[model samples]
Target: MWIVSALFAAVIAIFAQLTIPLPLIPITGQTFAIGLAVTILGLRYGSLSVLLYILLGAIGIPVFSGMSGGLGIITGPTGGYIIGFLPAALVMGIYLEKTRFTSSHAIIANIIGMCITLLFGAIWLKYFANLSWPAAFTSGIAPFLIVGVLKAIAAALAGVVVRQRLLSAKLLTTKTVSH
Candidate 1:
């Protein structure tokens, strides 16, 4: 069951990467998936699923943003953002599991995940792009904030919806069996 969930999330991530490409950094729904994935899969498998997606892209599977691939792609200006996904996914997964994925809890977890992604992205961009803190904030974060916030909201809603759906299904199944 866990494996199926992981595979489902991974497939969604790959499709999201291919379909959604931002200007320099692709605006992926994968981050949203990362939140929901972790909420559903928990920490260990959630992180592993993200790692699997990255590995597939790194090995020339064209799963990166805008169909970008290879090791060099990861080391580029956007590399930090790509690398950020690992910890972001892990943090979000663990946080969501701990909170039990209520709407409020999902909101908090989603924001934390986005912040972690931005933090790692900013620091890495500072080194790779050679930008100052202000510059990095201006370029690396400022542009993405609006869209990132939307993504976080969407992720949180998705998390709550999926959780409710699963719980309802489980309850229905239980009642049917009891009858």
Candidate 2:
């Protein structure tokens, strides 16, 4: 499961490295995948999944966006976000467990995760881009909200759908056994 999560997350990370025209942060769906991973895998596995992704990248695997890798990726403008994934996963998992996969819980958890990751991402952007605080927000935190919300919604939908499917399958099995 851990390996699956890690490999899945790494693929998402690489996919997420795609750039959209945002002055603050580059657009990527990796956050969506991260949140999805947390919701699905829960805390320990989720956090490890993201952590392993960073480690993989740092080890020079071309698993990051733009096919980039190594420790330098973490030291670059987007490094904060890379570093932030673990804590973000942790936060997402905690909320998932406590909220039990309700929509409200998913939303709140997602927002918190987004904020934390953005905070780290912005700080790293500043260090690398040599931007002031305001500049960082203007450039790094401003343009990603729409996509983030979309991703969260997708995660919620996936959860609801998956949950129902599992329940339905279990019911069918139980019915068959009773006959």
> Residue 176 error for model 1, in Å?
22
Question: For candidate 2, what is the TM-score?
Answer: 0.83
Error of 2 at 114 (Å): 0.8
Clashes of 2: 3
Candidate 1: stretches off by over 4 Å: 18-23, 170-179
Candidate whose lDDT is highest? 2
TM-score of each: 0.83, 0.83
lDDT of 2 by residue, 1-179 (tens): 65656765775676667656454456777787777666655666667778888888889887777778898877777789988878888988887776676667777787788888888888888878898999888777777667777777786666546544544666322222111
Candidate 1, residue 36: how far the Cα is off, in Å: 2.0
Candidate 1 lDDT trough over 10 residues, lowest sum: 170-179
Alpha carbon lDDT at 91, candidate 1 = 81
